[model samples]
Target: MPMTEEQLKGILRRFDTNGDGKISRRELRVGLRNLGLRFAGFRARRSLRHADANGDGVISEEEMNELAKYVSKWGISII
Candidate 1:
């Protein structure tokens, strides 16, 4: 099943070390790693590439849902 925005956000909160209300590449790296995913760094870069619309090098709150969708498309659950 695809991951939901809520689920994704929950994961973000769990891993948002800097508490900056955004998902930086580093944060996503840690998050995906906690998910037991291999190639987490690569996945983070890919997700940022897919979701960072403004090219700001981070996934803002506004881009979270998009990020969730991209991750779901990768068959990775938010949990």
Candidate 2:
């Protein structure tokens, strides 16, 4: 199943270490690692770019939803 808004928020909260309410590229790398994704450097950048719809170098709530959809489509287990 696709990730719910609460699930997304929970995941974001895990990596929003600064409590900024958003995930930056650095935070995304750490988050992915926490998810067992282990993305790095360009790979991490690409992943964030894909989710960052606004190209602001961060993942907002809406962009996080889009990421959840992509993850669901790819059968990625975020838990």
RMSD of each: 2.5, 3.3
Query: Best candidate, TM-score-wise?
Result: 1
TM-score of each: 0.83, 0.68
Computed on alpha carbons, the lDDT of every model, listed in order, comes to 0.82, 0.68
Q: Choose the strongest candidate by lDDT.
A: 1
lDDT tens digits, residue span 1-79, model 2: 5556568657665787888878888987777677776444554577677878888888876687766655444455455
Q: In angstroms, how far off is 37's CA in candidate 2? A: 2.1
> For model 2, what is the error of residue 16's alpha carbon versus the real structure, in angstroms, after optimal superposition?
0.8
Consecutive 10-residue window with the lowest summed lDDT within model 1: 70-79
